[model samples]
Each structure stands twice: as structure tokens, then as C-alpha cells.
Target chain A: MSVTSTTSQPNYHILSVLVQNRSGVLARVAGLFARRGYNIFSLAVAPTEDDALSRITIVVDVESTPLEQIVKQLFKLIEVVKISELDPRRSVERELLLATVRATCDDRGQVVELANIFEGKILAVGADAITVSLDGHPDKLDDFEELLRGYGIVELQRTGRVALPKLDREARLRAVKGKVV
Target chain B: MKMTGAQALIKALEMEGTEVMFGLPGGCILPAYDPLLDSSIRHILVRHEQGAGHMAEGYAHVTGRPGVAMVTSGPAATNMVTPLCDAYMDSIPMVCITGQVPTSAIGTDAFQECDTVGITRSVTKHNELVMSAQDLPLAIRQAFHIATTGRPGPTLIDIPKDVLQNSMEWHWPTDAEVIDSLPGYRPTMKGHPRMIKEAARLILESERPILYVGGGVLKARAAEALLELAELTNIHVVTTLMARGAFPDSHPLCLGMPGMHGTASAITAMQQSDLLVALGARFDDRITGKVSSFAQQAKIIHVDIDPAEQGKVRRPDVPIVGDCRLVIEEIVKAIRELLATGSTQADTSVWKSRISGWREQFPLSYEPSEPGEALKPQFCLEALRDSAPPDTILVSGVGQHQMWSSQYWRFDKPYTWVNSGGLGTMGFSVPAAIGAKVGRPEATVWAIDGDGCFQMTAQELVTASTERIPVKVAILNNSYLGMVRQWQEMFYEERYSEVYLSPDTPDFVKWAEAMGCVGIRVDSPEEVQPAIDRANSIDDRPVVVDFRVAASEKVFPMVPAGFGNDDLLLPPSQMARKEFLR
Candidate 1:
């Protein structure tokens, strides 16, 4: 059943979840979103500095579910240690995209030139194709993928966005001013 | 000290103060069962894993603690899915431990192996598969903590056999060890002072106010505070089916149950009210038929512990997320302060009289059977209520008999009425009653079941009889799934397809006797009270009284599934009257 709203415009929500680094924890977290019918637009997971803990960043559309409901549901999982909603405006968001396009001998140099224009690196060179990698904000990566699609892209993959909250500038300035000699 | 994982699990459960468990043993769980024999905790072997799960739920329902259930891998875990879902739906605190194949054999299609964690994850509040024996203690501790705290629900810990057999250094962890590990599970207990004050103001300003109580009040042990608020404000209270015993049925302001089979007065009062003080109650579709029209005129002040439940079904004007007991206490205090400051006085006498008029005009009534006729289920329930002790805990299986019992029995105290409210599991009564009896040995417990429901889990009676729990089981033997039959009769052109059960197959009394329970069958109206009395008098063993109630009896004052609350259908006698529709 659709909970909360039906007519409201969907807003993007980025939730950073800290969980125990154990087998099946990721599956349990993903299963919660799937079972609740909440669409996960993007997700990234990596072990935290502490080996015992793992951090997962998820981007979801909050049209059918309220943010409070999603957070509460996430908290219900015992393996989930902590969850914080990252404000998109105050967080650094990045995505990595890798694509392989069919590059004939004549167009291989052209492909390299185009990759340079987009700040992309050539990861691998095949007989008829070159794999290019790009890392930037999701929008930039989207732009890069759109430009490459014209080259008859043979393969494409994108890592969902991962984000970190930026330190508050005002608070950091005040802390710096209040620093002890 | 070093101990095997299974031994450490037993020790952990003991530290958690788990006195009893319900389970059945299997190959994967054999090692755990071996340790159980030496542990102080008593294990009641169940015929089915589902029975074990429900028994734990029943135990938890009464004790306000997490009930523990254990079963092996594969089919055993699959059998437990229903009870887990049932407990999850009702938000009952339960811990289910399932044995798994050895760690190396997890994905090899080993004997009696299944993905216990994967299967139970959606049904449980949380679940885990122990990768190491060292994690067992913390996992069990976390299971108990998660199960009991923050909107209680079932949690599972799947243990592979090798892990249970492996040795680990064991020590009982301090409170800090357990609490420090769980960083994200803090539940807000105190309602915001500003919201409490606003709720009080709304209640004071309401001309026709009703307090809508749900199962959360009982779960939070806030019934006394709820009663205090109702009596102090003179506001009428309508307890939903799950909240049957939350308010005294005999109270002047109590409007009985308000839902599908709710009393006419209760349904009408809710429909006509200007304001609703909803305490720990979610506006479930069962309680609020046709959500758009339910309490349309009422400005709701919804108080519950779970924030997700705030606007899940019905958005409240004022939503307070906190523990029910603490929130209700705050509301009572705020109301008292308001009265002292001359801000408001209880001036709902006019609205109160209108409710009283409704109560008198459309009381819950059933036709009394003629002499030597088949007994009415309502009559049997009333007789059972009269004969059973006042403090007796009434457990019910689902269907028409459940509604009839909820409608007819007058519950005066909280925790005395236990039934499957959200899931409405059919075979919940017998095992749950046994669990209730085990939890509260001093109190009398009765499993008021139906013929169809009794057949589903009647074998649990053998466990009760063998354990000497002495719970009473009253079968309202109507020879049909009466609720379905009633719906068919009313809405399906009387096409009773598969609703009817043959009377000759496995008579309930004979089945009860076979299980070593004191079996008594009553066919006539006069035999109803006598049978109940006989059942009540038996203390050494469990008693089963089969009252052959009217097969065609129907539950009245139904809102008819998807219909609006205002479209309540009264009893057949009043069905033709158009005036009562309003």
C-alpha cells in the first residue's frame, strides 16, 4: 500500500546508515527497502575505519513514503547501528561511471580526445573498443554518459552516489577563531 | 570460562530471565536441545513449530517480556513463518532461535538446511545468522533488547550447528556492554510538553470527545492512566478490539468495542464525536472502516510510541510520539492543571446524555434460544464469563466466536483479554492460553475457540495437559466457519460453499478426551452454564467444553468491510428501520 502521500512531488533523500560489518547485513537492509516498495535510486556500501562497522549510503525517492517513516523502518533492523539523513545541499556527492564504446581504428584517437574533454581516463583498450572511466558529481557523470551514448556504447556501469556531510563553514570559522594558542 | 555456543546461549537466556520456552527439536537444533536439558529454563515441546511460536507470543502477551521459541532449520523454520508474521503484525515481543546447518554446509544444500535469516527477515523486526560462536552471546542479548524495546516485535537468531558446537570464552556481559553495542535504538518515552498541553486544550474544548484506546495501551501498561484521564475528564472511552480489557467494560463512560463487530453505541459515538483522544492506537482499517469517512468530524489527538504510526493510516491534528503510559500521564497532568487554572471545565453533559440515549436505544443484543434449542454462541460466552473468575484471561481463536466473545464478555482489567488482532490467526487460542497460564500460573485462563479453529491446533491441548497447565478451552461448536458463513449469508446470496464443516468428523469433545483434557459437550441452553461450571471446577487437568451453538448466528452492528462507519448494519430485527442508520 502507498503510505503518506499520493499527489506530492517526489523529493530525493540520502540516508547514511552505519551497520555491523557482518554477512547478510547488507541484504537485510536492501530487503527492507524492497519489501516496503521504496525504490532505491542509488546505493553504496563500504567498511568504515572501524573494521567492525560498515557504512551504507542510499538515495531513494520519498514520494510514497515520508522521510520519518523510512528512517524509522531502517532503525527497526537490529544490524543497523545508526542512520543520518544527509542534506543534499550540505553534502559532497560523487558517482563513478565506466563505459566501453565501439571505437574503430579511425575513431580511436577521436574517442581519446572526447574522453580528455570530459576529464575521463582510459581504463582499458580493446581491439575495437576503449573503456573510459569518469568520476564526478552525479549530474556531471550523467552528462558524460549522454555524450558517450552517441558512440554506440557497448557497455556501461555506474556506481550509485556516495556522499559525506560537509563541515559547517560558520562553525568551523568560529572553532578556528576560538582555538587555543 | 569456556563453553560451547549452545551452552552459552542457555546461559544468556537465563541472564535475560527467560523462565520458559516453547519449541520442537530437530537434527540441526539437536545440540541446542541437549544444552536445554541441563538449563534451568523449562522447554515445552510443541507438536508444530507454529504452535511453539504462538505459545511464546501468548506468554509474552501476558508477561510483557519477550517470549522465546526454538526450532530447527528448513521445514521447521518455514513452519514458524505464520506465527512470526502474526506476532509481527500485532507487535508482540518474541525471540525465535532456529538451528541451521553447519557453516561450511550453509550453501551446499545440506540436510535440513534453509536460509532461515532470509526467509524471516521480512516477517521479523530484525534477524541474524551467527557467523561465529563468539557472536552468539551478543546476538542473543541484542535479540532480547530489540524484541522488547521500541514497538515490540519478533526477532530471530539463526545459529548454524557448528557454531553451537564450537567453544567460546563466555562471560555474562554487564548492562553497559549490551546497551553500548546498540547505538541506534533509542525510543522517545516522554511526549513533548507543548503537544501534551495542546492535546489537553483540544480535549477541554471538545463538545463531544471520545478516548480511542488500542492494544498499545495494554502493551505499555498505561490502562490505569487511561482510566484516570477518562474518569477525570468524564469523556466516553471506546476500546478497540485489541484494547478490549484496557478499559473496564462496566464503566459508565466505556463505550465497549468500536469496529467491525463493535457495539452500536460505540460505533455511533465515534462517528458523531467532535474530537478523539487516541491513546496508543493506530487507526487500522479494521477499526476505522473506510478511512475517509471514519471520525470525519473528529479532530484527532493521536499518541503512540512509534513515530511511523503517526500518520500511517490517518493523519492526526496533534501527533505525540512517546511511551503510552508516560504520554497518558502527561495528558492527565496537563488536563488537571488546565482545570485548576479555570481554563476549562468538563461540560460535556449534553453530549454525554446523547451517548447514553444511543446506548439505551441500541444495546448489543442476541436472541435467546428457546428451551431445548441449539445454544447461541453469545449465550455460551456470557455464561462462561459468569462462571469464570473475574481475573481470568480470555484467549480467543479467530472468526465469529471471537467477535461474539469480544462483544459479550465484560472485561474489567487490562491484560485479561488476549486475541490475534492484526493477523487474526485462526488457531491462536489453545497454545496462547497455555502460554498465558504458564506466564501467570495463579490466574485462570480460558481459550474460547471455534470448531474450525479448534481443529487447527487442538493438539496443543496435549501439551497443556502433559505440562499440567490446566487452562480451560471452550469450543463454540457451530459446525461451520461461522464468520465466513455469516458473510456469505448476508452478502453472497446465501451461497454457503465450503464454510460448512461436517458434524460427524472428529467431534471436539472426543478429541479433547483423546488429549487427556476433561471433555464436556453441551447441546441445550440449560447445559451451557453447567458445562462452564464443570470446566471451571476442574483444576488438575485442562478442560474442554464443546457448546453446540447456533450454526447460523451472525455478528451484528457490522460496518460491512469497506463501508463507512456511518453505514453500520444493526441486527436483523433493526435492519428494516431507516431511523437507526443515522
Candidate 2:
């Protein structure tokens, strides 16, 4: 709901930008970042509950750009409806990871147990490799991928990160949208 | 009625009340030009696409409407990029229609094809590539709506050739439908009342305050409100180059331009002020020489239509996002309400005294040329200013002449001063002047260009001549790229690298004659006034006056490249004193 500053600096800040669901909206959004020279770490886009609108979850590194400016420029984009920062403390973020791990039949049980412990699923079973898919918080996904790496992973893919503000009303509410820093 | 997309496009332009447009015919745009033959709209065929674009800008500047410029795909569209970017930077309301390649040929490198929508996405406020004949009218409508609205800017509609060739039933949407179509695009008309009250309170509390005006005031047509605020608050106004005539220059509270090449008085006043009510002026780098060192003592009340511009450079204490005129009007009302509650206007007598003293200390000046020496460019401009009517629209190309035009002219009216400000585009004057002339046919338009700028786009004079626009051109032909030469002399140790543009090679007077314009040459002090007078007398054709000026002159009171405004460098003779350094 708000961008509350933390003592520790974050390498990347996530922004959930609600935009009009129009053709070429993605290119327009991505083009804005490129035009302004804003470093975009990763982006995930999908239609929201309303079919007319889409939320583009952007992970942007604000080392050079002031976060306020990035948000302000986004507001200028014609299709951008609303921009809200997903503060690390007050937002839930998740990423989907699909990996093909190198494992022998003897090590298959260990890999499957690791996947189960991380809430992952075995999609395919090969002679020496097992394909696993995991959906969880990006950090948990990272840990799961690391465990699979020891089993000699052949391929890996992460679906960037998608986020939503934590719906706890009693807690602190600091709205920074359209606010000048 | 069923009509081709090309017919619909022309009909849409007519519906938008387009009186004139400047453009050229080419492969893709040829179809639209065909329907144009039946429309009542006047189309001025320009020599180059850049000229067409700039001409539209000039027209918009005078008319306060979105100017239209059309060009074919690829190279022609690319040529319009400068003017589109120029209009975008200055926030001129313009709709540039580019004839794109056929929808099927797009992204496949068809002959005369281009990714115009992709290329201009950043430079334009909004751009759409019309894919279907049915979408043409709505797209054109959207283009104008987006272009002329909030924080007005250049918008483009790229129509594929096939879309134009295809036919569909004409459907002109109502104004409400146009508004409903772009739900994400609504401009804030009024400032938040609380912020308005806070801004008014600041004006009441602050002793040393100044209204820092920019082009936004002009864009909003809020000069009267700005004038009211300044008078009511008794604050001196520093109009940036872009906002030259937004506040009358002859007003007692007016302090000419501020920033690099700005008046020393304006620069010092800004640095010394306690509160700066910045209306529509983004704190550009040229204005804020060193961002960290700029206006350290001032509290900012920044009002702009674009919320992004509020704190883009300096964090404002009170940031109001709304139309400039509307916010200023609200502030005026708030000030009156507060004053009724026993609050008094802040006294600014002592500040006025200091402003007057500074103005006297370093008035804009130039060394006079004797009978034998070439006329001073500043002197020539002064003559033109005196010889021309007070209402004459003055346009200038970028460089020394632009700075001088801003400095020398006494503009008392809004929309009288037009130039390429944000983009600093050279060769903007000729075509822009033509456009301005076309927009306001009764008023005389003079394009004050430098030798360097004139050579770049003087061919537009042929358009003016054939079209009988009767716009006058005064080229300060100093035989060199004067501004560059001045910088080289001052900064690069006088090693004038490629700056020496031979004075006599193309003979501007003869060149003007060749273009069917009345060409006059003047090199003496006495001849300057006569030349301008003669040019003013000619109404049948465009006039080109080549005033050979002294090449050594430099625009002064300059804030050097890296230094802060506090460290202003006056003329070379006064550099040692540093008396202006506050």
C-alpha cells in the first residue's frame, strides 16, 4: 500500500503498474523504460481481475534513478493507470521455476525429497535427469534451485517475480504513489 | 456515407477545424493527397519535411491550436523527427500524420517503409499505427485529443497505405466518445484546494519571493493570472526564454530572462530569493547551471500540468499538478481570501531596490560599430523591432540570434514570441515564420535568423514566396557560425575549428532573389533601419534582409558550462571585478 523506507538498501524495487489492456501496451511500457534509460531488472505482465486492465510487475534497479522519478515518468505513459510500489516488507512475491536436473536412479529419491520439501513437483522422469517445477516466493525458489544444482542441473528458468501488497489494514499504511520524494 | 480511409482522414481533419496544413506528397501519402484536392483546407507544400514540421510549430505558436504536418513513410517521416521532437520539448500542440507502409509490408522493410510509431514513441506524447480503415477517423480524433490536451505535446498517427486505400462507412464520434476512448488520459484542470491555499500562504509569508515563469503559462494562456499573482504579491517576475511574452516585458515587475545568457539581475534575484513560485517552468539544466548549487535559499512552489515535472529536478515544497492558468487563478482567489482575514501583502520595496540596482549595474549591451565596420547584430535587431509593428510575431532560429532576439525585443503580448526553446533547433525560423504568417495573416512575422541557421533551411523561403505568405527574414549574416565561434574564442582558446563559414559564398541577397523574395543587403549602421523599413513595406512577396554584422560579438552575462549561476561571467572587460557575484 505504501513505500516505507527500510534501513537496508534494496538492490531492486518492485512496482505493480496497472495499465489499460490494449494491444502493444507491453511494447509501449517496455519502450518507455528503454527510452528513459531506466534499468529494468525483470518484468512480468498479465491480465488482472478486470479484463480491461493488466498489471505489469516491474523489478527496477534504482541505483542511478530516483524511485520517485521512475514512478512519475510511468504516470506520463498514456496507458499507465496506477503505479504502486511493492515494498519488500509489505508485499508477497512469487516466481515459477522449471529445471531439468542431472540425477541417477539412486539419487532420484533425494532429488524428489528436496523438491517435495521445497513444495515442488516432478513433471517428467528421465533415465539420468528429472524435470521439476516449483512455485513459491523468489527466495524459496532460489534455495530449491540451489539444492537441485548440487544434483548437477542441466537447465533452469525463472518466471521473474510477480507481487501484490499484503492485505493487512491494521498495520502501517504509507502511500507513496504520486508522492514527490 | 461510405468513404475511403483517405477521405475519412481528410474529413476528420476538416472536422477538427483544420484551416491549413504543411506537407509533401510521396509514395504512401499520395493517396491522402488525392482526397485533399476535394477538401477546403489549404495545404502548403513545403520543400522539405523538416520545414513542414517547423511551419506547423510556428502556426501553432500563433494560433494556439494543434498544427498539422503530414509526410510520407521512411525518409520523409524521419525528416520530420526534428520538428516533432522540437514541438514535443516545447510542448507545442501538434498532430503529425505520417503515411506509413502498408500494414502487410510493415516490419518487413517494404520500399519507403519505416517503423514510425516505434521510432517516435519516446518523442511524441502518443502515437498510434492505424491498422484498419474503420479505425482511421477515431485514430485521427485521438491524435488531436491527446495532442491538444494536458501538458500539450506533439502526437502522431501513422496510417498504413492500404488502410487509406480501403473504404468504410464514415463514423464521426461525438466529443464525449473521444473523451471516453482515452480513459487513462485526463488532465487535472484545478489544483488541490489545500495546496492552492498553502501556495497563497507562502506568498503572504515570504518577504523575498519571485514568480519564476516558463512556457507552461503561455501554453495555459494564463498570462493574465500570472500577472495578477505578481502584482498582488508584489513579486518580481523572471520569465524564462520560453515564456518571453507570457508577462509583458515592459511591466515594472518584469525581470527579463534568467539562466545561461540571462540577465545578471534575474540570475542574482533567483539565487537571492526566499520563495520561488515556479509556474510551468521545469528547472532545466540551462536555468540551473549547477543543480546542487541552485537556489539554495529558496523554497519552491512548482506548478505544472505534468506531475512528473514537479520534482524532476528540485524537490518542491508545494507541488501542484494542474493547468497553470487554473492553479494560478486558484492561488489568486486564495490570496484574496487570506487577505480578507487581516493578512497583508508582503512588502518587497527593498527587494525591488536591489533588482533595480543590479539591472543598472549590468544592462544588456554591445559595442557599437562605426560607419566603416559591419553593423552590430543587436543594433540591426533593434532597428527591426522599432521598424516593425508592436504586434509583429517575432520568431528566431537557435544560436546567438535566438538569444539576441530574446534579449533585444520588447514583447508586451502573449504568443508574440516563438522560437525553438527546449530543443534549441537551428534553421527553425524561416518555415516557422511562414507558418506563423499563415496562422495570423494580418500580423507581420519576422524570422530573425543567424547566418549559420539561415543556410540550413532558407529554402523554405521559396514556399513563402510561391504561397505569398509575406513573412520577413532578417539574417544576421556574420560570415561565421557566430555562437560556435564565440564559444571557441572564449572556451577553446580561439582555435575556431570549422566555425568560419565564409561570408560571401552564397550571397544571401542574391539567394533570396533567386527564391522570388525581395532581397536587400545592409552592412552599415544607418542602413539597418532602412533595410528593415523596406522589408516591412513589401507585402506582395517574402522579404529576406541580409544584415552583415560584426563577427566578434558574444551573448554575455553567461553562466559558463560548469559554473553555478552565482559565478556569472559578464563581458570580458568586467570579468576581473566579479562585482556581480553575489
lDDT of 2 by residue, B267-356 (tens): 989989999999999999989899999999999999999988978899999999999999999999999999999998778788778888
Candidate 2: list runs displaced more than 4 Å: A1-11, A169-181, B573-577
Tens digits of lDDT, candidate 2, A1-181? 1111221247679999999998778888888788888988778999999999999999888888888889988888888888899997889888898999998999999999998988789999999999999998777876777678798989888887899988565443433332322
Clashing pairs in 1: none
Error of 1 at B531 (Å): 1.8
Which regions of candidate 1 deviate over 4 angstroms? A1-10, A166-168, A171-181, B371-373, B576-582
Chain A TM-score, cand. 2:
0.85
- What is the lDDT, from 0 to 100, of the residue B139 in candidate 2? 90
DockQ score, prediction 1:
0.54
